[model samples]
Target: MAVLKKQLEDMRGIRYDIASLKGSISNLKTPTARQFVSPRQMMTNGKTPTKRSTPNPIGVGPSCISRKKPVRGNDPRKSAARTKARRRILQGKQISEDMMAALQMEDLKQLCSMHNVRYRGMPQARVALRKIPGLIVSDTEDLPNRSATGEEVQGANMEDAQSVESESEEEDDDSSEEAEYFEGPEASKDVQPSAH
Candidate 1:
């Protein structure tokens, strides 16, 4: 009789489970609960699915100024002291003696003009320019020097044209001299004592 009662309790539990499942199915069918239901799986147009188009969210689009963007705070000149002139400036050193001594009369004049220093001649200009603080030498000290004024440039151009013409004449005279030096192994052997 106890086994029959236990069997009856199991049968009741099965029925209760079926009733709960039916309730869930009914809830799923309701319009309010079915709000999240996906649209019908039927394809649009010619029954093909299409991916939605989206703008690239990464880098700048077509409006970017240059393809190579300047990364923030990455100046190579600043990072590496590539030049002695740059290193000197960074160290806050005064005018280098070599640069100061190498300074031409024109350079001193230019410096004196910058500081509004009045000087009679090259010596006075050099002295006055040396006295001024924060005088800077150009990084391109090795570059071909140019005068500050237009008049000087005009005179220089005339001189250059004349020199070019003169050099052509000099080249003609030197051609015979150059030929002796270009006699291959014979010329080099002449410089030696003939290896007695």
Candidate 2:
């Protein structure tokens, strides 16, 4: 009789658990009035949203900005130094020891650009700046001094171009001469003897 009574208590406990599970399932399927919240109120937190002047499809705000180019312009002091160097060249004057000593690495680079000298990978130091004048002098060696009418400058340009062409032609001739000297043996054609 006691065993049957314990089984009855166990069955009652299981039924109570099943009843609680069904109540929770019904509550989930049909939400209560307190669970229903308007989306506008939830998003804005019960406050009115601000209006936008334009539609931002990309979502990039105006506050996030960037510059495409450098803020600094070509340094005026560097330009003045280059002008001085050009004047010296026009006067048929050499880059003096005093002038060379005064210029910085940046000034040397500016001067190099003005004279069309390839300054890439060149050392950026006071001592290295000394070699730049030799390159400039070599480039402008054949150039004439400045004239009243500026015709000498134009003439100098033409002469420079002609000299460049002659150098290239000389190089081409040297290559052809090398090819002649290094000529390979010609292959002999294999002819079949007459079948007759």
Reference-based TM-score of each model: 0.22, 0.21
- lDDT agreement with native, every candidate: 0.58, 0.59
- Candidate 2 residue-wise lDDT, 37-97, digit = tens: 5465444466545556876679677875767664485666655665666567456456544
Q: lDDT of model 2 at residue 43?
A: 47
The local lDDT score (0 to 100) that residue 194 gets in candidate 1 is 23
Runs in model 2 lying further than 4 Å from the true structure = 1-70, 95-121, 124-196
Q: Distance from true position, residue 104, model 1, in Å?
A: 1.1
RMSD of 2: 26.9
Find the candidate with the highest TM-score and give its number.
1
Q: Candidate 1: how large is its RMSD? A: 30.8
- How well is each residue in 44-148 modelled by candidate 1, as lDDT tens digits? 553545578778788757665666878886655533432443344345444443455555566566556656899998778767766765554334332223455
- Which stretches of model 1 miss by more than 4 angstroms? 1-94, 136-196
Model 1 C-alpha lDDT versus the unseen true structure: 0.58
